[model samples]
Target: MADLHVESTVQDNTDHSPQNNEDVQKCHVVVPTTGMKFESEDEIYSFYNNYAYQMGFGVRISSKRKKPHKTYYALGCHKRGVYESKAESSKQSKSCKTDCPAKISVIVDYDGTCAISCVSLEHNHALSPKKSRFQRSHKKIDSYSKRRLELNDSAGIPLAKIFHSLVVEAEGYENLAFGERDCRNYIAKARQLRLGKGDAEALRDYFVRMQKRSTNFFYVIDMDDEGRLKNVFWADARSRAAYQLFGDVVFFDSTYLTNKYNMPFAPFVGVNHHGQFMLFGCGLVSREDTETYVWLLKSWLECMDGHAPKAIITYQCRAIQGAVAHVFPDSLHRLCLWHIMKKVPEKLGKLNQYKAIKKTLKSLVYESIQSQEFEDGWSQMIKEYALDKNDWLCSLFDDRKRWVPLYVKVIFWAGMSTTQRSEGMNAFFDDYVNSKTSLRQFVEQYDNALKSKKEKETKADFDSLNASYKLMTGFHFEKQFQASYTNAMFKLVQIELQCMLFCNHSLLKTHGTISTFNVTDILRGKRGELKRKVVYTVSFDEVGRDIQCSCHLFEFRGIICRHMMKILIEKDVKEIPSCYILSRWRKDLKHRHYHVINCYEDLKSGGHAKQFEQLCSSFYEVAHIANSQEKYDYLLKCIALAKEKLSDDSSWSVNTNTNTISQDAHIVSEPKKPLLPPAQVRSKGHPPTKRKESKIEQVTKKKRKINVHEANGISSVNDNIYRRSYDFDLNH
Candidate 1:
């Protein structure tokens, strides 16, 4: 069949009237004419595809001929072909052919310039401008869209949101050249390109590059018998350094499956002095067995200079418990109280008086101030509620020592009794990764997330230095902490100080250095009108200047409780004992690891960068002190003399511009071959599955299933809940 060709240009020389001007304007919609020219063949295809998009049809290269001197091409409607039937045994294919006979012919001259010789603007079938952008040839991801998609995908934005954002930017879906599928395909291709060798190889290459740039960047890879990657662990210098300062307690969790290989993301998280989550280490493991966890914990411990946290919190997992016992025997292993309590409804919801039982259980667990009190309350509740037959409850009781706050209050936990910090860390990571992410992309996004976290910590550090809070109690102790602790920690102490208003303490007895007092505290319940009165015992020591509260808030959280504060004020104690002021939470303490640069930092000067920063700090202090002109001039002279002396010493020469190791060069010398990606493994817990569609998706799918607008005199129900309820009442 021969393709039909039409003139691309429509000229109206006699168009002097308004209607004629409108027609001329309508005709000039950027369509290619018979004499249109292009710089290259790609441009020719692009122009025709654009025209096809505007004309509401798809275009394709129908025919092409190439010779030594000339090249010929014919671009036609995708439907301009004869249809052929195939056997049922063959793979099913959808054909869109109706012999449209619409085409444009182009010729490339000796100079390599393409000029349109013939053009067609007609199609045999009906053309819908709204659907043209969906055409195969017309749908192409432009460079701008590609970059935007990549960035949004890296930031863990869903496809629907990405598509909606693009559609909004383009005004409407009809105005967009590419659809959601094209965006998805482009991102998939980008991932493939990013993983040049493979996912495992690319990740190793990235780790190698990072390690070379930052010597303190640590990573360890575990391989299966077949040498395939089984698990991987890594910790940057900042995280390692942070662990040294905030390593008293840690939260370990591995519930999130954030990669294609289905490896769980395990992060060793801790609370910094500022009460922000500090990542100690991270790992991706195929198995959740005790062996795998032991390896991860040992690797993390080694990275952090073999310092095991005093207490570790985790979800209820036997594998983790066993691993902790093996690697950190002396460390207290506490299960996540939140995770255990979250299962209350599932385990006991069907029982009679379930609400009462749940309320009593909560009071029994949280309100108890001592271990014996909790044990007594638990026994009473189990018998009162007839829960003796509940195996889950029995198991929980067996493990109560690990999760119950009163049992663990004697140990320092940085005020955390649950693994919520780890959960928070996981939530933070959700902004950078999703289930469909590949291992390579996960590693890359990890760096981005870490950099963002570092930026937040730096901002917090700056704020702590320049900001201060109003003293609530006007006590010397409050002033002492306000001057020493970070702003976040000071706020916590201020909370205790303010609570002192509700506390009334009286001397019960005195024993030489120790005087026991009974303290009564009035606290408000969550219900607005409810108030509770509780009595606590406080012991004060005049020799040591120490006051211990029976509430044990100071022992557990490193903050003085209201009872202790009240007793101290009664004793006329003007200053807090240095023993009570924890250096771990102090603002002025600095760790060497804080100076260790991460892979994201500038590495041109290598190890000298840390020295440069130290020198800059010293110079800044000197500059701050030299307020007078005479002192400033003398300081400048001293700096000049030091510089001269340093320059004259040949052995002290250091180049600040270049290092022996190029930042971009690959330094890994092992594996001689690219490593194979880890096989998709079935991790512990529920098997990995696609994320459940959101409520918006469910509504959209429902709308798609039944178009109410097109139904016979049918309409969708009122979407507003209040309106729906009102309408229901009216109908009733």
Candidate 2:
């Protein structure tokens, strides 16, 4: 057996002449050891055609030639002629086989070389050209069908499935919409045909393409001309999602983003117990405009799945009030007391009158007075101001019926009467939202800030709960049980004790000290009246342990006043009863942990310093004036004593006449000339008899000048003196 080899090379320009052919042809031949036979040209042609077709090659076989024992064949052409050929030999010698007759075969080509050869036939199978008749038609169908059935990558998840999945993963998707991961998974799954990668490099390239596409779309949709995202409207899906997660009680407010009055931007906020204002929307409006307020309220309600809120608190803006009334009719609308207080002075026309009004308003809010008492106080306020009765003020007082009792219990005791809670939340948010954030990023930051605030508030609420419990049960019972008194009776006694401590401490303390003094003989018998007087006046009730005192320290401090302490000792309450200790009364004295003013350095260092300095200067001047009055009083007393000494001395007198005179002479020098009869004076006489003048009067009279500084302690040049003469003389 032998194997067959067939090889041919073809070239362009088919001409038989080798000179004209820059073409080459190569050939391979095969020989068979066993006798080989072609049998017929038809078979050779069939085999050549089959081989050419199977190998996907062009072939032309030349005519096959047969001899007595061998055959030659040429295959393929170059230069329009067969230049390549193969020869085979078929032979058998007598010594080679016994059964078969010996035969020798030789095949020769154009070169006439002969050898024994066997054709070794190996069959190669491949797809035939006839089989591809339907390929083009099938390909056309595939391309057209693929186009008709084009599946959107975004559609693969089915909106329902995407929504459901997001809802599940995000726990209702509260306020979350699609982010990078969501978008990536959606693109990958829905666009499997387009985006699938056959290799790692292809996968990386696909991801880069997707990122570019997503970025372009996100940028166009979110950002404005300045490349800053318009953080105004929340996506509809997100708004609904948040409504599903959080029920009503969503508090909303707004803050300015820029200082520009013209380009006003307000970021609307919603707050929770965590003190976080989850920014849900934004708008453009002035502070005084109500249009934004109305829109915000409507949008917020729509966001909350159309659920009505239980309450709303905001600053005292008339526009806001009108908007709120229009939008949330059922909600309990309240004014932020801080804002109300701030605006009160403006309403009253001057800041000078605010203090008095503020005090009165505060008392009205917090005090548990009867309706009549409230009315009387209100009337008195109007009278004091000489103002006509205002309907709004009356309405305010009547509105107290809605929330007063509860507010009085909680807010009054806490010293909070305002929705300052919202302001605090706003302050927290102002620090959180910055210029760089997109709406999506802002939402995420808000959620995180809220979580932190919730943790802190939870801890505080727990501590307050525990304290309240201890105050009500633990401490309350301990004091009652220790005193071997029934709880109700013990509480009654405690109230009386507290009242006495608050009202009368000094008298009780003095009485107790006096009683001890008599027992120890600390007081002498001469002081016995004082001791007895004090003892009789300051005795603690033997049955109830009530103490009567005049110091009123007990009424003021509410602690076990020193007087109460003495009474407690006298009653053999050796160990101080906790009942006498009012924890709340001592709260002011206790160390405070919370910051009084905000912890912001700007507020403390700048605004607060100016106010504190002004207050200090005012109090200093008042103290100086008060001290000056005390010194003036003592000086006045000394001046009075000096004036008394000047009146008592005789040498201090001044002589009025030219002749020297003693103090008695100066008093008696003035002469009485004459006296009329009482009967004549009663008759109203027209004229009287002339009298002779004294010779001393007829002599030249000297006009004397007296020094006024010597008489009245005032320095002056001269004083005129005139003497009176009582002479009843009638001139003819």
Candidate 3:
């Protein structure tokens, strides 16, 4: 048992007088004093213990022996009561001097009893109940929980459900971890139905669905710091899927995402003619080094289900070329003219020269240019520029010829020249993905963007058919052309024939056709030239025995000269060759019925008729404005107005040349005896009398002066010509 004791005593050491006798009696043992009295040690100790306990304090009392007959009481207790009592007294003193406006009472019911509570003089209110502080705080927590529960119920979604949906849409369902929202939702749903607490098989099935769905959500993985591809494993999977769906002929190109110190290499791949970007493969490289190119190609090839591509179209880069040659040896490689054009200035120096170089390089692709011409041009260019004359350039030029006719036809008919399809797709990627984006996000966004663009393009193509058909047979053509006959026109026709032949030959080769027709024959028959008129020229130059015609058709149009046509005609060709018709021009005649008669009607029918109408209107307006006759009339009106304005300005004068006759000059007199000599001569057998000593020199001089005056008059017509230069300068 714990020890418990209380003791108290008081010391008295003074002689008392008779008046103090009453106080002594009041202090006597067992005496009850109504007002106040000295208490014995036992009573004092008991009172202190009770007060200490009430005040939440403990007290100990000790009896001290100060004298033989008297004892002293020493009390020790917590200072809480003393401090609290002093504080109360101080508060009371302050309250007593100040008066509040009105008495305020608060009623409280405790244990079925009513109590009126009022502000005390010592303080604003009674001591605060310790329970009240905790109760107030507890109410706030309860309110918060109640509001949260209400929100959850109204939304009809647990916090876990919302979070799981987000994660499923983000990282995918299969990758959800134990604490992930999806997992929690699955568990909660399962338990709420009184199902088993743990179902490993169900959990596995959920993850499998998530993983399967993740494929639909594409992702691009960039390279890690160690030069390994980071998250883009999906690219490999996607490439395989694409290959399975569509056979090879993938167009690939690389572009930078940012100018930051650390940047990812974005390599994109697209299907052949569909212009669909199947995937964007990205990786980090220290620099665009040879190893990086090799790895990129290898990774892409691997992602392509380890199957060799039939062909790869990309920009011309040495590293890329080398890598392709090494890795995709079987793949026919082609360069994107869009990128090549952008890159040429850096290699050749000077942008202005690009036009000329492009034109020259473009001719290499024309099949009409004989192998001999290509070789000659290649040699000359190499010699002029001191290039290496490598076999690679030769092969490049050779391969370009195979596609040149298609490119020309597409440009002429479809009006699509550059690889803007790829460029536009890349621009879309830049908009959707930024530097800080993770590989996973880039993949999803790129896939979405690609899918969207493809759908848009399909719709656009459908809508564009109307405009394209109109453009193929529009009035603008007639307005733009004037009747003219020139040897150049015939020369161009012959060249066009040769180009057709080249294209047809390529098609024949590609399609394995049995029929063969040369372009030269058709050209000759169309030009009304006989076979005998064809002439072959031999030169010591690279072309050797190649034929040349007076028209120089081959030189101008990079085609077979008309002479070749006459020779081909002598061979007696029958069918029109396929190459003569460009694919762009050779549209399916079946679709001709769909031509839009009215643009508004076509638009109402949901097509690109409105755009087509606007384009046609613009073309017609420009053509009309460019009419020569109208321009000439406008010029004449302007000239008349200018003359009127000049007449109005009195200070303005037309300068005229001054002419004067010199009166100081006189003619010398001649001898008059010349007539007598003429008569003498007549007397002597003279038909010779005609000599007649005439003043012929003076007459000749006069005639010369008259001619000079006439010449001056003729020269005055050129005065306007001189004025033209001044006029031009002023106008400028």
Candidate 4:
């Protein structure tokens, strides 16, 4: 049966006069009589609906009859019928129905006009005119309000704020006809319409459209055997192109819950020349197994043109470790130093001398400049602290090569010792996306985050070009770096040059063209006392002007160490060699990817809208160029020829590959049926629980330092925690 509820908008057309004029039309005092005539059934409903609205009741069609010449309709109160109970309902709910006899019968005469034949005017329940706006039949969202809500939503305003604005516009809650829930429901349906068919299909269409805009845009969709989306990876052209330059050391972390589907957000992060975090690529994976990690890594490698990074840093996950080994065999796999250090207090916090043990461990990990030094210190500390029986310590010692700073200092890490770059990237994206963000919305917000990051990079580039830093030292080497390196990198070089004052060196030995010198660094420690003199051996070849330091600061980081600077000054070298100045840190390098336009600019309205935008852009450019008469004539001819060439009657064939998009990302046509959205599953850990803060952060959050107090020959917990956290900063 069709819905019996008749919704008619009530317009206020009050006729005010001392006496009622027969010619004045009345709407609020509509009365149903036995001989009332109407133009059609619609007019009858409008008249009764207005009366019901004014009387604070609802009207509906109680019955209808149709037979050639004898057609009639019966209207009554909405709650005029008896309520029936259903056993199938799990819970009982209140119904508004009551056996009210108030009704009117309208009959269609032979002339096709409707007239009231019967009337009964009596109601069973009381009604309030002020509360009538809340009734289901009377509530409505007008076109102006809907457009305003949509505009606010598109501008990223919160729904609560939108509803508040609407309420304010209507003067009060009673003045507004619709409620917040109604507005929310309407917006939800509007979003559904925008995401045509389904969210997965909308995502696929977005990927295809982006790829069409830029061929360098790459995306891969991994589907399960059931054709459901399992994992997705994508990188814009700018990111892909950036990988060619800064992909030597990468930070990959998958700790963030990125979407409503509970997929892990894994981003491959790198550092650009300006020491800014750069996104190489990112992916969303449903699983954290070795197979899933392997596929994600492989897809990223393909997107970066199969040029594996020299080093990759990540948290200590067994699955990721195995995947990194399998997919990037030649790449140096290093565990994040911060991840291991943050667990120090948790793993060994119960020890009686926990502060002493933490201090010794930090000194062993960070102060040791050589692999043998770290090994010897680690063994001595374990034996001194009697920690040989601790399983966690044993496991960490066994995997020392993957996290120990002294063990992995052979390769350049862009001056990074941990995966904090990935953490910083995640912090940046936290402002735009959340756990409830949909896949399509995630991509759109991801573009916004990239734009914000790029704007910073652009500003940094501008600063590098226009700003200049004064040289702290008068050395020719400092002057040379000031001219060659960026302002940021040059400041680092100047710091090293300034530290040469504290570096005292003496000639050790000479062999052929190689001269060795022992340099002692004397600097104030964190406690404000002179630190113990640490000796470093510097080897300099006069013939090649080559220098090497035992500290390996230059080998691990790109900057030349103070020890080398001391030796260079002693040798009377006027300027540093060009080989020591890395091109990655230079200010004059030209960026090639800046020419590519942003991929998400025209993505809000996908498909034909993008095509229309491109045509509009092309025409605008043509019009701009056709200012002169001769150029205008040439453009007219070109337009005619282009139109003729595109006037083909042949059908355009679209590729319908749904499982995987190629690395080149040839446009994959949207499927006739959209695949179902990925099923929700718990992430790697408890989804609802917030991540616990490490002991160091929690303890030091309120105060950076606390005086140690002895109570019954025991130190306070906060004092011990603060001291241990102090060691973390000292190491850094």
Superposition error at 204 for model 3 (Å) = 21
Q: TM-score, each model? A: 0.76, 0.29, 0.34, 0.71
Worst 10 residues of 3 by lDDT: 723-732
* Tens-place lDDT digits, model 1, residues 1-732: 222122335452322111111111122345566788888888888888876665567887867889888999899989998988876657777789999878889999888899989866556676655577678886778756775787677665777799899999999887788888888888777766655548888888778777888888999999888879999999887888777778888988887544778787888888887777778989998888999999999999889888888889988777888999999999889987767776788779999989999999888777777678888888999899899999888988999999887677767888664324235676567567766678877776787788888788778778888887988766798889988999988988887777778788788999999999999988765463436677889988889886777777777788888788888888889987798999887888776656877766222234674575567678779889999999999998998998788766675756776567686576664546557789988755532222232233445657764576548566765443111110000000
Tell me model 2's lDDT, rounded to 2 decimals.
Answer: 0.38
**Model 4 over residues 529-633: C-alpha lDDT tens digits?**
886678889999999999998877777778898899988888999977898999988888886766667666433465775675577678879899899999999
> Residue by residue across 52-77, what tens digits does model 2's lDDT show?
33322234434457775556655331
Distance (Å) between predicted and true CA of 52, model 2? 75
Candidate 3: regions farther than 4 A off: 1-212, 215-233, 236-240, 259-261, 272-287, 350-368, 384-424, 434-444, 457-732
Error of 3 at 674 (Å): 99
Global Cα RMSD, each model:
12.9, 50.9, 43.1, 11.5
- How many steric overlaps are in each model, in order? 0, 21, 9, 0
- Give residue 443's error in model 2 in angstroms: 7.6
lDDT scores of the candidates, listed in order: 0.76, 0.38, 0.37, 0.76
